[model samples]
Target: LRSTTVRNLDGVFELMAQATKGTRDAAAEEGAHVLAEMSPKLGSAVERQIGRLEADVEHLLDEVFDAQIFEGVAALKSHDNYTFEHSVDVAFYGVMLGRKLALGNEYLKDLALGCLLHDIGKMYVDERVLNKPGKLTASEFRQVMRHTVLGFQLVRQMPINSPRPAHVALQHHEQQGGGGYPNHLTGTNLLARTPRERFDTSRMMLLSELTAVADVCSALSSDRPHRAALPATEVLTVLRQMAGGHLNRQAVEAFVSMVEVFPVGVHVRFNGGKYAGSYGVVVKCTPGAANRPVVRLLFDAQGAPVPEGVEIDLRKLPDDGELTAVPEEGVSVEEYAHRLAIARH
Candidate 1:
């Protein structure tokens, strides 16, 4: 409920994590009950839960786009909670991206609501296929893809007046050049435009385009049963690669500008340089230079933990590639918490 900008983001992140967990739990319960009873009267609970978190979402926007915090927060997800957690994260990312695109307050409200329930229809999917840890067969993938239409149908049944949220659920998966599913809807073409022009003209992409970018970013950056989360740097690269083809280019471009690639509290390793093989945690991100953060080295080249980490400003370094995201195996939520405790003490 705190709206102040936080200097120590760890505590703020913990609060936001609790909010997302609560929202996720409530949505999951409501979605399941609605699915089983078939009377479809649980929309109010989902809406109420999301409404309560609007302040928290605004707080999240004030802080860093810490992918590591989300990685740790989303670790709270079990197989059953995946969709709910994903929905909240998408809402967070979507609203953040929407603000970057200058989509005013009214549009942002709709975007947040749309992103929150964008995957509600997944409650109707087969649990086995939804949580399958292995590659899905073509037919299984097809079944999984039906969540879009199913989600649209489910959202339309809700009491909301605007159809924008329902359309978001339906068209989030749709791609440019007409290659997407459920409906082969083609989005606005930004390929011929400049970044400024794209930004000026991006509102036509609307709620669905914003949600699509957010959805892809959250899915790729978070752990899946099939694979571990990609590194933030790699996620940035993937977002760029998918921009014009699978996602809204204007949204993706705006997202890349705002995302914290080496977010605070993330474990990192020196890819090369004098500190090669040394491990560290990102302690700060210089605004507008997310890829270059201030690091506090926590482990030596021999993998021994340092009692007191030495801080290094990445921007002060001569080379940009001196530091890189640590491999997924190298990061531990405990280690991150421990480092924060040390800093706080």
Candidate 2:
């Protein structure tokens, strides 16, 4: 039934899919109402269960991150403009990334909040500007920056219990460079006083970073108000090159692993596996290798995408052909792990 609820709610996502320059506010308000209705029906136990599941998800990521040291990116399949839809996706992704970073409880809570309200600023932007088909003029862009201020003002007005997200609402666009608007503040200057140890920002900033990564990755990887998403591998490459100076290195690394560049539930084109090794998600296995790495023989392992089906575990070299040793040169193990998690989701 809970799964049914999620499915039904996901169905509602289509209603707001055509959203553009004029329907943002209505979409936000409708989304708010929809969430209000769904939260209660989900029940306290389900809520707690979801919460614990989130924790477990975080735990798994923490171990993965500790072992490899990376931030974690999201692998969203949709890109509708509904604020609630995008916000929830970002929050889920943020929490997942927070777990990977081994963030503390309070910070994790803030990260969750940050993920929720990181886009509160969008509420203030005109529907036209928010959904413009093309680039905006300098002045129009400046008006967009006002969303952060407007978001902070709106949150201050509300008697909402949480302030952590409100802060993210205010600082989400404040870039690493002092060039960011509102207060020409640079680097940490644009950040908020968070539950962080050093560069803390209610933990949301980090999630905001994750959100930003996911938001852009999803946008660039999917159809948007102005254009269609780009190639998945191209998206990864761009992020890789933009690391350090423009984006966070740790965050980028996690994101690459998160998407499981070697996507799950789908067959992979290995570097060199028998029949070139076309395999599906190994739901029963861990990150290393799918317990029964399903395969649907079609393509060779030369990085070429081919139509493959779910079949047998190719990891166990065939009895007919004696194998020398386990093959190496293919998909990254980290990608395999993240894909497994995504498949289970």
Candidate 3:
């Protein structure tokens, strides 16, 4: 990541804050509106809005070296709707990874736009099936799967200069091998599903591959109608397991590097009683050392607040003695303080 990219990402956070004006509902409703306008024709107003979003994302990529901006966006992930928040999250993650991959500004813009609208076709999906809390019947599942094709059709009508958004909408769900759905396109077969002018038979385009990674990440980190959100560590582990067979390995790796396994600000406890049952907040994540981060120790083994917190860099530990394990859901500040006060007596 470059310094300029980091600066741009900082700007993106400010832009996103301004876009929503401090309301998650407003942000979600704005995204919902965009998805609603996708039918029949894309219209000039929608196209311009998409363009503005693209430009904002491009600014985010212009300074990709900063982790603070990524952490800032991560802090805002507690949104209400899976539909709207998922789109914005995917766009943010996609652009972050794209910048890490050193993609040009124009390509980043297109990738961000594609990710933001990848699920626009889901607007046509049956609400009952989309919002169902239980396992879907086979027929219901099929209706859900149709969103990809529907999304492709809707995005194709947009006046955007590139066809990448439509292509991504069609191919994001397709796996690396011949196993994925709707079209089940594998290898050369996948090429036929996207526009021939923008894609080649030699390989899957990076835009689709990047968007797929972002889609999976955002969905896994979100609370869906069917399941609770998975932790970031678990999500990355699942993505790594799918690499080479179901996902693009390079894209997955880039995502892992950009977001890290632990991510900053998540509360965690050392495994095996390494810190005497103390809980800590992750302050910085070292790339490649996914499990080890610089943590600010806040609670002691006796369940007492540390008062002046201690910062520990887990990466410095010897390989044999490296800290292990993070709680599925990390300790909350309030929970920690309350528990500590009770134990002190």
Candidate 4:
């Protein structure tokens, strides 16, 4: 199975090299194509194939500078495309956060490449273990964890211009204070000759730390083999809880401040108040206040269409008025029609 998977991936890589054009979306799409072809395989074939993406990856970064982080949560839950889509989401998040931190252009490009291919090593793990519907046994879990080292080794062998990007694949799983996998690296460990230096954030490479933040956000917002995607609000709460211990405190805070927890395009329902039972789609979001956005009311409290849409700015609503995410199952046919009505607006 592994050999077959590797052979298929090699063919896919050759196709990607031929199909990838200079456009950023093309590069991104071709890269995703390669990712979708991955399975439990490892070796020079994987390494060489990844090298084929270098030009496209660099070209993709140039285009990413003006791109917004797309909110494609509904699209991402499709079981077959989850891995590829998740990688794209991570790249979007990492590059944007890199911009937020004022990283130089070169650094941003490296961050983008690293985040996009960070999980390539997962291709080396068996599909059974990777997609098991229940909790992994200890041995299966260890196989999953080994992807970090496998990814690091695979990336190191590639012809990528910079070595720093490889480290993002290697260390994004490492924690701040202590307990993490593969290597128990800390944020400030190298400079911690004295105890005081341990508290500083400079020891770990900034790109790695930033990618970690992006990686976590993307993972929480995505569906996995074992679980459904968490609502964006719950994802934010989990991110906050992990800060300072499991994640870099400063990076987490910066990410949270910039990302819209309740991003546009999601259908939401009023949790309580006069508007309770009303349905709407988020139309706009403010950076600093992610939980609240401008919603376009589509359905009334009685579950009937509003006829003519009405806009409400959630930030201006009373404290008791709250918007809750509507599950995929909760979207009605009428709501879907309204959602389609303004999709391009």
Among these predicted structures, which one has the highest TM-score?
Answer: 3
| Residue 95, model 2: Cα distance from true site in angstroms | 0.9
Residue-level lDDT of model 3, residues 1-345, one tens digit each, is 223333343343343334333333332333324433434453455555555556655555654436666543342233245656567667778888777777777888888778877886665566888999999998888777877776676566666678888878887887778577656654432212356634544455678888888888877878887788876667778889988778877677767755655567777766543675667788887655656679888777665677645798877763523343466465677776787677677
- The best candidate by lDDT is 4
Where is model 4 more than 4 Å wrong at Cα? 1-52, 67-80, 188-203, 261-267, 272-283, 295-312, 316-322, 327-345
Backbone atom clashes (below 3 Å) for every candidate: 0, 12, 9, 0
lDDT of 1 by residue, 165-262 (tens): 87888878888767887778776645344565445422334678789888887887778888887766777788889988788777778777667677
TM-score of each: 0.62, 0.54, 0.67, 0.65
Task: Report every candidate's CA lDDT.
Answer: 0.65, 0.48, 0.65, 0.66
Worst 10 residues of 1 by lDDT: 1-10
Model 3 residue runs over 4 Å out of place are: 1-80, 186-203, 260-267, 272-284, 287-290, 295-312, 316-345
- lDDT-wise, the better of 1 and 2 is 1
**In angstroms, how far off is 69's CA in candidate 4?**
6.8
Which residue runs does candidate 2 get wrong by more than 4 Å?
1-75, 78-82, 160-163, 184-208, 268-345
Best of the two (1, 4) by lDDT = 4
Query: Which sections of candidate 1 miss by over 4 Å?
Result: 1-81, 189-204, 264-284, 294-319, 327-345
